[model samples]
Target: MKNLNLKSLYRQIEREYEELRRLNKRELEERKKIVYAQIPEIKEIDDLIKGIGLASAKEQIMNPSSDSLERANEGIVELRTKKEELLKNAGYERSFLDKLNSCEKCKDTGVQEDGRRCSCMENRLSRELYNVSNLSYTLQRENFNTFDLGIFSREIHKEEGISPRENMDMILKISREFIDTFKINNDMNLLFYGPTGQGKTFMINCIAKELLDKNVNVVYQTAFTLCEVMEDQKFRRNEINDIKYRQLFNADLLIVDDLGIEVTNSFTAAGIFNIINKRLLGGKKTVISTNLSPNELTKTYTDRVTSRVFQKFYPIKFFGEDLRLK
Candidate 1:
């Protein structure tokens, strides 16, 4: 997994905290209104508590006598006790009128008073990773356990010597091992290339699901969509920071699907090369699934892009009948 961006995560947490506080305040005010409507005497109790508290503070500051201080403290405590009793008799707890935070430990602040991350913040970070992954809906159906190897033919091929089923079985094992040992082998990139419906996309989706379940950030984008976003970000008049551009390079795992089908131009060629080359240099993992052959890829993109791909990526050629047809 790539390193978690603590700064970004903390920013999100802060927003959540502010929202939570607003919600808690609203809930408390609404509940208090209802309670006051039911028992008008509750408002009197509140005023009494406040009056006694103010008088106690005035006495302590002006008089500074032990007897006066003790009597003031006693009077404040008596008023509070009377307030609680009135609330209880009206079938409401004293705390029911207070703003109730969603997280008691940190009061929905996402951090402790000692400046440590709260458990709720970790959960929020995991949820944020899922939201940005782009695979949340598809991962439900596309995972390693859901992959069907029976779609591949068991009959042997004369040239390859192995049946499609056997070849796919080997690929499946390799993919499983890759996910299992991802921590140590994170720099190992994968290139799944072959004809359409050969399970290239399925294999990459499986890898994504596995990593995402472990709270690893995975960015999935079709080649066409990715190019469009990059192009828009490049030409857009606004100077605001674009999240898509950042995730392209910063995500722990980037899966580019249908690589050869995008609209080809100078910008796309340079964008693809930059993404692949920079990710390689940063030791981030990437998976590319393409229907194009090696020659077709070289023709579609620049020689520099193809060279980096072939050199850095572990090429897995998928050769089987279309599983979608099956």
Candidate 2:
């Protein structure tokens, strides 16, 4: 999984907020309208706090007086109480008032976070990610029903050891179990290695879709595309540091579709190893779909990478003839 693009996370958040508002339409509209109407005043409220924040900083640095600190504390308490009351009158909860999913440390106006404008920091990072890609399509594509297992053939399953329906039954059950118990079981680092058009990607998507519905963060990228992006980032170093390095290595679950297709090189090898190794170390789950068999991958990459994957990843060798015949 590449680092979770925060833009994707923000888009998901906004989408969910909208969905809930839509769901609660009868009572939500007036409350929502009031919040929207007050949006313009957010700047004014934010401006009002700077003086107090500045004084508190100065006191802490120069005099370190309990008196000035107490006053600053009183100001915060009063402002927050007013904000809470405002929210209550509007029928919006304190949670909704913190839109931008505001920094939990400082509430909405950025008066806190070590006495600096922390909201601006979070907003800046979010804006950088938002500029990378609009990931709304990726989110929608995770819908489980989008998978048409009919694309994989019955004769193919027989060749592998089961009927098509039997194979599907297991896959479906496993998928559901994975979703139902994800927090406890986590992902198994699934390897859907078998024939082309054998529903490997579809199965991965089914799991991704189910997990996303559970509010799990997920990222999808092909090996080639991921390497290309990483290479560009590495070469440019510091050009784009909006997302942290650990984020790419530690998504709750990442789906790398078509894993063995990237052109093998030292850089690509290291990149792949870093992603797989990091996830495995943290016990995070990854789902990789590939046309390559374990043997093929071992030959292409190092025994180390392949062995680590095979040792940890649960194999779900997809079986079927190409369904194009039917």
Number of the top candidate by TM-score? Answer: 1
User: lDDT tens string, model 2, 169-253?
Assistant: 6777777777777777554667778877666766776776677566566666677766765775677454244243334565567
Instruction: Give the alpha carbon lDDT tens digit for every residue of 13-36 in model 1.
Output: 798789989989999889878887
TM-score of 2: 0.60
Best-fitting candidate, scored by lDDT: 1
lDDT of 1: 0.76
Displacement of the residue 7 alpha carbon in candidate 1, Å: 16
Model 1: number of backbone collisions: 0
Clashing pairs in 2: 3-248
The estimated TM-scores of all candidates read 0.61, 0.60
Model 1 residue 297 CA deviation (Å) reads 1.5
Candidates' C-alpha lDDT: 0.76, 0.64
Question: Model 1, stretches more than 4 Å misplaced?
Answer: 1-134, 237-241
